[model samples]
Target: MSRLTRRRALRTLAVPALAAALALPLLAPPAQAQAGRNVRLLVGFPAGGGSDVIARLLAEKLKDELGGANVIVENKPGAGGQLAAQALKSAPADGSTFFVTHDHTVSILPLVVKTPGFDTAHDFVPVAGFATFANAWAVSGGTPAKSMAEYVAWVKNAGGGKGAVGIPAPASVPEFLVRLVAEKYKLDLVAAPYRGSAPMMADMLGNQIGAGLGSVPDFIDNHRHGKLRVVAVMGDKRQAQLPDVPTLAELGLPGFEDLPFYGVFAPAGTPRPVTDAFSAALAKVVALPDVKERLTAMGLSVGHVPGAQFGAKERAYSAAWAKVIKASGFVPQ
Candidate 1:
């Protein structure tokens, strides 16, 4: 072949090679995008709250698990975790951002909110679930009621069948339980919703509210110190941290056998490898002896549930609560 012809052929091959090189980024997943970058771990509650505490605890170890990548906890507290969920939706799905939240924002919020602004199934992918927790009904120190039966009697007599209870957020499972308690005992009990458990707990500690329903972790320390009393808990079995607290079923409140879960999620379209890597790291973190002990002490039944199984659990939990919400005739806001 002539030298000029050979040169032309090489030029032609180079054009396709250059085109393929440019297209590689667009066609393939950003598998390495999560590496060597700061990870933002978002929590939908204020600092010092249960979700925030859990996020910080996991963040500490997850940073090391990710080969020394920094994991920063960013709190976006409002609308019962709606803001954080929406933040995840708007964020870049490059695996640098993740939301750590529980069943409320993902499962129950969509069910109760007429327009939650983001759909969990459409906007997010489950990364992992670390534990399941039970919700407990607690009374303030001012209340003489130390047991479920006594608490019911106290509420029945308050203002001649009128009372108010605090909940971490509006349209939550705690609110549903409040409604159930009202119907069972025939009291005019109202649910007063707060931004998060922290504020509700503040009110409880100040004796502003006679009773509140929240996670066992939310009330465990207070219950232990006698600052408040946890009279009843939701779940089939007693929580390990509050073994003396009777199950709501044992108190004849049998509907809330299902427990809530805590899990992490990444924005939809994040590379599966990125999410899987985080999930695997989270599993190791959860299995750490100190992490397991701390979580159990905080009333969580700690276990490492993979992403797919976590997602399935979320769906089943949502379905179970749908019936309760429907029966209660709750108008979505």
Candidate 2:
């Protein structure tokens, strides 16, 4: 063959090859795009709070589990975790980010807020669960009430006015519980919502509020130290950490029995492989004996519900809370 003809044939083949190379970038897969990328773990509460602690704990180990990927925790900290959830919605779904939060942010918030920034069911993918947390109602150490029955009698008197109770956030499960308690026991109790459990707890310690409601983990240490008294916990049975504390059902309020959940989530459409990888790594971390001991020490249980089951769990939680919120006639603030 002539040299010029051969050269023309090679140039013709090169045209299609160059075109195909240009198209490759558009078809890039999530796995290659996410390889060795920095991961952002988010918490919707202050740095010292339990949510933040859990996120940081999982973040440190997850980094090693994910093959030494750079992982960092960012605290968004407002609106009862609404800000962090919305921020997660705005992130790229490439699998480098996740939010560690409780049922309030995922299942309860959307039911209370009329126009929440994102849909709980569609905006994020539930990746993994840490545990179910039982909310507890407690009184200040000096309040002269050590048991649920005594606490009810104390609230009934309450200086001849409605007793004030500190709740962690407005429109939260605890806030609704205040109403439920009011209706069931025929006691006048006012709900005072605060930024978070820590601040509300400060007032409880100062004796500014007779009683407070929050997650048992938030109250257990103080309760154990004699700074506060947990009267009743909101679950079917007493927690191992607070075995002496009566369950709500044990106190005759059968409706306030469901324990709230805690879990992590990635933005919607995040690659399944990426979420599954995180779930697998987390199972290992949660199974560690130290992890279980520490979690139980803080009033948490070691219940690891994986991605799909967790999503279903979150939905069922939402359905139940919707009825409670509606029945309470709470107007979101």
Candidate 3:
């Protein structure tokens, strides 16, 4: 064929090729296309802890809600979620990685740690706040104390007014509470810090530690089984799951009126639409009857707050803790 004829034939084939390429994206189904795509839900506590259990539950439900995305929970336990927060900071903000944590890592840590490595305001974007919960002061089988007063009395009698109280992590709200408890009772009480709630609970169950302060979810099962005794709880009101337990405010230890929160956050710079999608999916998941029932049984007041509104709540909660930390004269470590 002549050069002109060959050129004309090539142009005809190129037109069809370009049209087919343009139609490819439209032909793919959003859900099916994401079938093998992996989405990681990161928890900063060891397996069997409250945070880890919640993450696993969410991951199971989120797989279906997030358009067939293969959601998985990854535990990056250390430094009371410091390592996980740092990991989230370095993760790509393409909706692939998210941190599932409680107020301790986000609100309390920043107020207590000298340099937590990741800034909550600058390093992360709040995806959603799922629930709020109380923290409880519980006595292990090792102690004869049934209530806070008895616990105080027991501390006074034991070893000449010196005892150790176990806290899930160092420089956390429970540690601060331990200090306040010591001051209130005028005892030389030491706060023992553990990597996460699971190990702390292990020690408490084994009677290696006399007492501990942690989330209601952390102690609810054990308390119900008579493994431990929950004496005083934080927040303004008594927990529904443990109604017989008295609030700290009623016991004259009134600083922790604000309840702790549970939330999911993505790395900073994640697109708003991406976060919004996650928030919506989480809301739906939290609304499920079984999911809500499970969380409630675990000691959480299950509710879903959207991303932007949740972020505002987070800031307000952080600010409130800041005042309490200042009043306690806690130097950021």
TM-score per candidate: 0.91, 0.87, 0.90
Give the range where candidate 3 is weakest over 10 consecutive residues by summed lDDT.
25-34
Clashing pairs in 2: none
Tens-digit lDDT string for candidate 3 (102-186): 9999888888888889999999999999999998999998899999999888988885898888899998889989989898889
- In terms of lDDT, model 1 sits at 0.90
Candidate 3: C-alpha lDDT: 0.90
Model 1, span 154-179: residue lDDT tens: 87776577888999999999999999
Q: If both were scored by TM-score, which would come out higher, candidate 1 or candidate 3? A: 1
Say which prediction, candidate 1 or candidate 2, comes out ahead on lDDT: 1
RMSD vs true structure, all candidates: 3.6, 4.7, 5.2
Find the number of clashing residue pairs for candidate 3: 1
